[model samples]
Target: MSDYLRLENVSKTFGGIRAVNDVSFALKQGEIVGLIGPNGAGKTTLVNVITGVHPASLGRVIFQGEEVTRQKPFQAARRGLARTFQIVQPFPEMTVLDNVAAGALFGGSPEGLAEAREHAHRHLAFVGLDPIADQPAASLTLPNRKRLELAKSLAMNPKVLMLDEVNAGLNTGEIDTALDLIRRISERGITILLIEHLMKVVMSVSQRLLVLHHGALIAEGEPQKVVNDQHVVEAYLGEKFAKRLKEMGHA
Candidate 1:
């Protein structure tokens, strides 16, 4: 099967600084890939380039066999790509359902408000936010707000979903809940690229792992192999983590 998404020699620069440099990878359809790196690893910058929040300074971003390197954010959305921010940004004044409905109305192909809302309701249910649908978005807890973000993105009917640190501030139970939701999403045939700091969460959910350091691709492979790689250890995981992993028999 063809790659569902491909980044070829992709680079993004802000003035003289290269936020993403010479990074390339392919995401197969229906696969869950994890992207992990330390702070300032350019992970979010790479996501911005892929989602068209920032255009690449060089190279190509191909999606579903088409070149979308310079597409605008709305254009990318229309082409069935969706992303959730690390910081959830809901329309505070709107009801949870309405906020999600807006995504269906604009990002997807819903015909009218009624259809959009119906789609939104289903998405909210999928993300376990249906009970709070009528509540104000601002009233939600952090975990609920994260679910709201996922619901809003799902309402877009995206073929590829890019999630940025969706489990950042959650407790163990909340992270498990998020992991289950992510698994359900992948089971529905949506290709996922997840950027997360939680090692256990990423290790458990991702079929493959991609590591970035100093704006470049450091490693990419099966989760276990990639985590145990010497370069990956030195670049991101550090020696202490490697020793701990070996002690835990993960080596």
Candidate 2:
């Protein structure tokens, strides 16, 4: 299949500092690709560039066969790209359902508030948040907040979803629930680009992994192989992680 999303020689700079340097990759439709890196490794910067939170200092971003290198965030969303922030930003005073309805209203083709609310209800149910649909978003715990973020994005009816650290603060059981939700989303045929720190989640969910270090692409391949790569281990996972994986017969 042709690439659904392509970042060609993409780079981002703030003042004199290069946050993402000449990164290039292609993501196929219906695939879950993991973007993994250490802190300050440009993972979020790259996502920002893709979502148009920050324009690229160099190169192109092609989505669904169109160049959207300079598209604004809302423009990108209108063209079927949606994202969830690492820090959840639900509308505090809105009911959880209304918060998701806002996404349906703004992210895609224009819709009436009633239709948007219906979409919101469907998506909230999809993320298992239907029981609390009437609650204020600010009332949710961390895990449910993450689900709200996911539901909001889903309500946009996006073809490509970029998730930033959706599993960041969840405990093991909650992480498992998040993983299941993600899998269900994937099953619905949304292409996913995931940035996550948890190796187990990334390894289990991703069809491919991309490793970034110091603002550059260092490795891109199957998760198992990428995790075992010497450079990836040295740069992100460390030798101790590699040794432990080997001890567990995973490397």
Candidate 3:
């Protein structure tokens, strides 16, 4: 695998506070990389910087060897950097198909609405939401709504998909289904950056892991190794537990 997306010394500041601090990493093509951190660790901020929701205060974002640090959200999508929001917010009044069609039309750069809707149908089927394509987005259950979100991103023909807390509100069975969907999506050659809190989900799905704390990249390596790092364990389990693990030679 080769580097598909690279961030060089990325940092983001909100007023006087730094939300993302000199963070740098790369996503290799056709790999699923998990980004884990405690709440307020600026994981989403890093994603925003990559997707152009918030331009990085310093450093660069390179995609397929091209610099895109200043691109807007729409431009990010058009460049095949698609993402799902932690909060699923589809247009309530529109049919689910139309909502996904909007992504295809606006970001996928299809020739017209007819071609966009065609792409939407294909994506709906991919996410197992084809049966509910005509229903209003507001009517679906939470798990189905989450699947709809995946469909919308897929409709954009993403090369890299940043999933922010996609399993946040899912039940065990729903998460299993989602895991399967993610694997299937990966099979299509889309690189994934999964920002998740669920250890089970992240550890199981990720090929590699990146741990962030206090807006900095603290650990990056294989999942088990990263999870056991002193800084990562300390960030999640507090210094006492981390010290205990160190004493036990588990850190």
Candidate 4:
């Protein structure tokens, strides 16, 4: 696979606090990347930087061989970079179909809506949301609403899709649905950058894992290896996590 998205020497600060500190990584075409970190670890900040929600304080964002640093959200969308928020925002008044259709209509091309809707329908199907096509987006359950979020982002036809906690607030069954959706998405050739706390979800869905702590990458590797790394264990599990893991035969 070729490089689809790249972030180099990226940094962001709020006053004196560095939200992201010299973070750099490259995402390959069609690779599902798991971006993991504890709260306030700047995982979401990195996502926002790439999506143009918050411009990078320093560094460059390259997409498809071109520099896109500081580009507007709409401009990035036009260039096939789309992201789903941690908070689901839907037009409560609009039907599921219409809500997703708007993504294709606005984010992609006016001419793309008709085509985008067809694609949207398939994507909704991929996310297991087709059965409620005519229902108002606000009426769905939380898990399905998350699916709608994925569908809406899919409708944008992004080359690099950034998903922030798409699996949060889900039950076991709902998480199964989310995993299936993510698997199908990767199968369809959409490169993904997911920031999730669910170890099960990230372990199963991502092809590679990038672990961040305090806005800097500390580990990068296959999921299993990274999970057991001393630094990774410390980041997720407190100081005694190693001993706990040994008691459970994980160490």
Candidate 5:
């Protein structure tokens, strides 16, 4: 597959602090890549820079062979770069269907409300939320809310979807469901950048893994190899536990 998204020496700074530093990677078309790191590892900051929530302080953000280092969030969406937040925030007063409809409209689709609704319902049904599409967005449970978020993002008709902790709050069963949904999405030929902290989830779902430590890309390769790297084990899994797992021939 071709490189659909690329970040070249990207860095993001806030005042005196550097949140992301010289991080660079690429996402191939139709592949699911996992971005994993410990808390405060600047994972979200990198995504922000890519989607234009915060432009990179240095380097370029390229998508589909074009430089978009300074494009705004809406522009990113219109360009088929879509992302889900770590915290799922839906339009509180709107019905679930309408919330997704808003994504289709604002995502740069030239469709009117009627056409947007038509698209939204299909996405909602795909995410298994069509049963309660008329309910207020605020009324759904946590798992269903996450599903609604996926539906909203899908309604945007993304070519590349960056999922930031989409399974953050789910139970084991819910995570299984979410995993299935992600695989189905990938089957539709959408490239996925999954930002996750769960080792089992990332390892199982990712075709490749990128590990970050202190805002730097510490490791990137096959999932097992990256996880076994001393830097990744030390920074993410901690030295002591990694040693134990290694001793047991598990890591």
Candidate 6:
């Protein structure tokens, strides 16, 4: 399969500390991939580099058969690449519908207002937030805020969408909603790269898993296998926790 997005030896450093260390990965069209690691594992930094929020210390970012390592964020968005923040970013003063409509208007789609509103409505319904569409984006609860974020990102109509910890701050019920929405997104033929914390979501949704630690990839494989791998266990899960997970048959 052709890669919809590729990162080659991408590295980002701050002073003497390397936040991302020569990381490399490729995401194919219509695939959902998971990236996870302990705190400060360089996951967010990598996303920043790919989205051009930070320049790669050394490497290239390729999308749609073209090199876009230094391209601006808006440039990447026009090339069918878009991302969501770990924290929701909404136009607090705007109604949810209008906020999402902005993405439709400017997210590389020149469709008219009716078409854009039609598109945003489809995405809002997909996220189960249609009932609250007329409300202010900031007025929604935390889970709904996340839904709105996903909706806004979806409004952009990206081929490859990168999410930074979409499930980080949710309760079980909220997390469930987020997981289901993510599945629905994949069903729409949108490829996803998720940097997530909650293990249940990761193991449940990811086809392939990549583990990072201290700015380096230490494991990549089937979720269960990688989680139980000795090095991965030691690096992230403590020995006791790893063994207990094995005994419980989750590792």
lDDT of 6 by residue, 1-251 (tens): 88888889889999999999988888888888889889999998888888788989898999888999998888777777888898787999898988788887768685687788888888899888898889988798888888888888888888888888998778888888788888888887899998887767887888888899999888887888988888888888778877766777767
Instruction: Residues 94-213, candidate 4: write the lDDT tens digits.
Output: 989888898887576657657767877877887778988989988988887888988889888888889999888889988887777777777877799989988767777788899889
Off by over 4 Å in 3: 237-251
Q: In angstroms, how far off is 117's CA in candidate 1?
A: 0.6
Go through the candidates in order and give the C-alpha RMSD of each one to the true structure.
1.1, 1.0, 2.8, 2.2, 1.7, 1.7
TM-score of 5: 0.96
lDDT of 5 by residue, 1-251 (tens): 77899999999999989999999899999999999998999999998999899989999999999999999999999999999999999998999999999999879784599999999999999999999999999999999999999999999999999999999989999999999999999999999999998777887789999988889999999877886898888789887766665566545
User: Lowest lDDT 10-mer window, candidate 3?
Assistant: 242-251
Q: Give the TM-score of candidate 1.
A: 0.97
Q: Candidates' TM-scores? A: 0.97, 0.97, 0.94, 0.91, 0.96, 0.93
Per-residue error for 80 in candidate 3, Å, reads: 0.4
Cα deviation in Å at residue 3, candidate 6?
Answer: 2.3
- Cα error, residue 28 of model 2, in Å, equals 0.3
Decide which is better by lDDT, 5 or 6.
Answer: 5
Off by over 4 Å in 6: 112-114
Candidate 3: what lDDT?
0.91
- Which pairs clash (backbone N, Cα, C closer than 3 Å) in model 3? none
Per-model CA lDDT versus the true structure: 0.92, 0.91, 0.91, 0.85, 0.91, 0.85
Please identify which of the two predictions, 3 or 5, would achieve the higher TM-score against the true structure.
5
